[model samples]
Target: MNVGQPKHLSRFPAKTDLTHQEFWRGLPTLQAEAVLLGPGRLEYKMLQVTGRDLLIFRSKVAPKMASTIVPHPDWVVLMVPVDWHGDYVFNGQVARPFDVFVSGGPDGYSTTGEKRHNLALGVRKSSLKEACANLSGRYIEDVALDDQQIALGAAVGTRFHRRILETIAASLEKSLGSGKFALDAVVENDLFSEIANLIMAETIEQNSVSSINLDPVRVVRRAEELFEDRTTNPPSIADLCKAANVGTTKLHLCFNEVYGVSPIAYLQAKRITQARCTYLSAEKVPPSVKDAALSFGFTHSGRFAKRYRYFFGEYPSETLNKR
Candidate 1:
């Protein structure tokens, strides 16, 4: 389990990360990889407190768009996004600011993006199961992976969000700092019991919500695979269509639904950043700007430069020359 160091707390406590990737994101224990989906330098931090039974963290990431695969597994996790000011999508669902993301029953895979001021907690699945069984006086079946809207009453959501923050604060004080924070078993039990009770009470608000349409997820995932496989020569719309096996209309709608951008626009943004990576990581040969663009299948030099500048805030030439 990778734990976070309380770096920069004295000088920049607001920016310190109490939990590194593994403690909150389930690294090494399970499979996880993150690819940045937005432009500019990534500003990421987490304020986290962990116990043997549970781990909670406040994640703050800017240029927040990301494609994450299995960040948490064998753990039931919830995310309360606080002050997520703009559009965001989780899996195939367009999430509201106050919405809670309950996942980790069967498949804990999630891809979320844009603005992510989120407070989340992960309880070991077996522990949660035992808790629910003991608390509810019966075997409990918690929610399956929620691939749909889960409406949270405004007051209830806010209250829970505050509670989570308070608990973290208290844990920090008890541990004496963020560097060596861990929840006492009693604290963990009480907090986790609340989560279990919430689930048992069916407070997650999914019954009335519509079931998620998986078509978009399938479409986008297929296209993403194509992009990954053909990075040296990014696939055309026709190629994407064939690979995804969807018509142009369905493709456009589904792509926009999942990523909030049309296929072409998302592709340009993704592929352009990749080209910059190429320039930065080039070993033997000093890759020229033109070569980088062409390697990412950008045929039109003017369009490539424009897209590069638009996404990265600098011209491709500037990046290559710097490299």
Candidate 2:
């Protein structure tokens, strides 16, 4: 019976372009961290809207990078790619334009890409479950209640993908926050029902890699934890292997399989990324780049600057001067 237009939407201004920091700060995620993988400055654009029970974002980013995003604890996030100029990986799976990547877990998801355009929706788990239960047309049995994260995909011209586009349009538009009307319960139910029906729809079109063993993922995660916790002395391959409880050969294989990089290089990339943060936030130039480098375990100035440029697309001095 509810008929009012949406008034629950938060008033986040639409953005045409943003710096890497601005873009990361704006994502509705918890403890989100991003690292640059390609050289040069990054370009990003984001249009965002939020509701009490949901958040929607239309965004694009360039120059290729990786991000570890931990979304709201009570919500299930769905990422739909509208344009993918290069490989886009989400949760270690290649995200195609046809599939809607979905996840809701404590561990969150890892995303990396270049020249990617996407629509992301974060819907409250309780609200979504209620909507699925109350859907009038679809039988209750169609919607699986399993807790595992999954990507739902269908062939082109299918109703599911079309409805996703429609959802993105409605969720990202300002109309939801305009005027006297409110997005009442009835309208919300209808919207969620549309999503629910599509998600539970049979015969999804999917041709992705088969399930991975997941042991490699665990090894990488353990190694990251050890590296992050270490100070003054970086762990050697032996230490990393001991921490990960795997042999050196197995550790290398796992790291490469998971991140497409060897352990040492990948960990080094992470270490320097912390230094970039200090530069990004510095009010005035820090006393010296070498101080920052040496503190983060970079002893050789030439090697530090070269690696910094590769990861952030700028020299340490240049990044220090940006702000």
Candidate 3:
């Protein structure tokens, strides 16, 4: 995470020649699990300001996709969806285009949308606090908690909020022609301050609740971690419930809220992903598809092949033979 000055400052054309791996590698932060939901080629374009701890970027994704993201630890992202129609799920709560969302630290989030254009700014936690304090005379000590609560409470956007977003976009467009230059610290600070002031002045604030009530998100995250750790020997639903300290019914609800799937189904999907990775990475005489599937906990080869094809749009054998 070394921030350097952006060498290029132009809005590039929509790049359609990226593979799934290439697209994932280009993302600034966040570990994403992505699934292309449409048949057409994925189209994307980005305008980014490089080389500063406080960075601004706008990107558009066409031909719908579903993605789950784990945010970066040191940055807080404020995102405004332009020409975006879909819901973003954060901590089990959903936010729409007119709602601005904030995220900090490592949190799980999911976005499913069609042809989305988003303007996002990533600022370090310390810079964000300084900006907010300079603008509003108040500081946020725990940004991740505050952002989660805001998302859970559904912070709605107002006319002024829309105007702020428009202004920010306009500023980015103007700066695109400025060429490569080291971003001045004072200039970066002022820019962040302006954005923070707009957010503070326009967005509505709700009451903060205690952490005891927010245990469901934590439980779901813990279950996901456990599934990842023991992919070959995943825990049963009952075992997961015991580990998460929740009942079967509560676990189901939490899993559905976060992943749109039951715990068992999510685990199965993870196993399939692991199997695909193993199949693709095998070198010097790859393993048979059956062996790969069974190695990742797929008991029945036939069922595993069907599930793998359905999820990845290719048969397991096809993937196994590619390399």
Best by lDDT: 1
TM-score of 2: 0.47
Model 2: residue 286 alpha-carbon error in angstroms? 62
lDDT of each: 0.60, 0.60, 0.56
Better of 1 and 3 by lDDT: 1
Alpha carbon lDDT of residue 201, candidate 2? 47
Candidate 2, 188-297: lDDT as tens digits: 43345455544544322221222356488997888778766764345544446556665445666789999999976776777688778767764655647866765565
Relative to the unseen true structure, what is the C-alpha lDDT of residue 110 in candidate 1, on a scale of 0 to 100?
69
2 or 3, which is superior by TM-score?
Answer: 2
Among these predictions, the greatest TM-score belongs to: 1
lDDT of 1 by residue, 1-323 (tens): 11121222122134364323533343323555566776745555766677886887676676656655453456666766665545666667777645767776455546566655667777787777655444333333643334333566666776676567556655554463544466644346456656765665553332221224547898789878987787655665545655665534456777899989997677667777778778777575657776566556553467779878887899978876777
The C-alpha stretches of model 2 lying farther than 4 A from their native spots are 1-14, 24-28, 136-187, 202-323
Tens digit of per-residue lDDT, candidate 3, span 172-225 = 423534321233332353355455544554442321222357566887987777
Question: What would the TM-scores of all predictions be?
Answer: 0.52, 0.47, 0.45
Cα lDDT of candidate 3 equals 0.56
